[model samples]
Target: MAEVTAEARIEAPTGKVWERLTDFGSYGEWNATHTNFPDGGPETLAAGSTFTENMKLMGFPAEVLWTIEELEDGRVLAIRGKGPMGVIVGTRYSLAEDGGATKVRIDGEFTGAAVSLMAGKLKDSATAALTESLRKLSGLVA
Candidate 1:
């Protein structure tokens, strides 16, 4: 398995940050790995809701079918997906209000036979993408 995480303190309230984070319509604007939502994002996000997203990572494009595993309004969102080559992917977005700013963190996990073949490179790529996504998200909301 390969795991990656990134966090940032955005100069914005948790509410504002959460709005942008869940606004899948504008996801590509700030999400570095997001290419597009093939069937559009979930109309309502709740545990068990499913969505399809196209993503680019490590110079490759893949389609992932994701199911929301957990949701806590503005606090947390977690999803698990099935990707190419039988790979399993999990992502979680966490937010906390800190003073007037928001502390945001993204955690990603990848597993399966394919992941073992490229764990190191995948970690690097995913870490970079997560960091870049947080930077862009901050730019939009902060």
Candidate 2:
């Protein structure tokens, strides 16, 4: 298994950030990473809530089927999914207050033949992409 983690401090309150984070329904609007998010009613996102999103990784079409594994208000969110191409992936998002800012961390685990072969480069790309995505999220909510 290969993992990559990225953290960013945003100039926003935890409440504001949480709202944006949980607004999965509108991810495609401002989220640069996801291109096509499923059209569904609002999701409560408790354990077992499932979502489907079509996105791109390195400009290649990727479909993700995410199921909420855990949730802790203002603290943690974890989701797991698997896709074609032998992909097994998990994502975790955590948030904490730091003075006047919110510290957000995104950690990802990917295990697959294709991922293991380029683990090093994937780590670097994940770091960069997550950082930029967080920055964008902060800006959108700021």
Candidate 3:
């Protein structure tokens, strides 16, 4: 298994940050790993919503069928997905309102037999992607 995390203190309000975070239609614009959503993304991100997205991880293309596990308007969103080769991926996006800005954190976990082989490389690539994604998101909203 591989776990990765990244956080950023964005210079924007939580609502602004959340808007960009949950804007699935434009995910590829700010999400570093996103390529496209072939079947489209959730129009509403409430719990139980499902979406399919194509992404790249460790330089390999993967299609993920994701289910919204948790959602709290502008505060938190969590999703668990099944990727190729029996890989299970879980990701959580959390937002906290600081004094004048919002602190956003992304935590991701990968598990399955496939993950054990390249856990180290996956961790490095995923961690960097998370950081880059946050930077892009911040640039867009913050």
Candidate 4:
């Protein structure tokens, strides 16, 4: 298994940050790993919602069928998904309001026989992507 976590303190309220982060239509504009969302972001975010997303990881195009596992409005959103080659992937986005700023964190995990083969490279690539995504997101909302 490989895991990566990244966080950023954006100069904006949690509600403002959450609104931009969950905006599926503009996702490609600020999200670093986004390639496309065939079905788009969830019409409404809830625990049982599902979405199909196409993304690039380690410069390889892959698709993930994701099911929302948990939701807490502007505070948390977690999803578990199946990716190419039988890999299981999970990502969690957490937000907290700190005065006028929001502290956002993204935690991701990958597991499967395929993941083991390139765990080191995958971790590095994923970490960089997450960090860059947060930077872009921050710029958009802050």
Candidate 4 per-residue lDDT, tens place, 1-142, comes to 9999999999999999999988889988877888999977887788989999999999999999999999999999899999999999999999999989999999999999999999999999999999999999999988
Better lDDT candidate (1, 4): 1
**Winning model by TM-score:** 1
Candidate 2 structure lDDT: 0.79
Q: All candidates' TM-scores? A: 0.99, 0.89, 0.98, 0.97
RMSD of each: 0.4, 1.8, 0.6, 0.7
What is the lDDT of every predicted structure here? Answer: 0.98, 0.79, 0.95, 0.93
* Residue clash pairs of candidate 4: none
User: Which pairs of residues have clashing backbones in candidate 1?
Assistant: none
* lDDT accuracy of residue 89 in candidate 1: 98
- Write one digit per residue (lDDT tens) for candidate 1, span 1-142: 9999999999999999999999999999999999999899998889999999999999999999999999999999999999999999999999999999999999999999999999999999999999999999999998
Ten-residue stretch with the least lDDT total in model 2: 33-42
**How would you order the candidates by TM-score, starting with the best?**
1, 3, 4, 2
lDDT of 3 at 123: 98
Q: In model 3, what lDDT does residue 100 have? A: 78
Cα RMSD for predicted model 1:
0.4
Better of 1 and 2 by lDDT: 1
Model 3 scores worst on lDDT over the 10 consecutive residues at 37-46
* Candidates 1 and 3 compared by TM-score, better number: 1
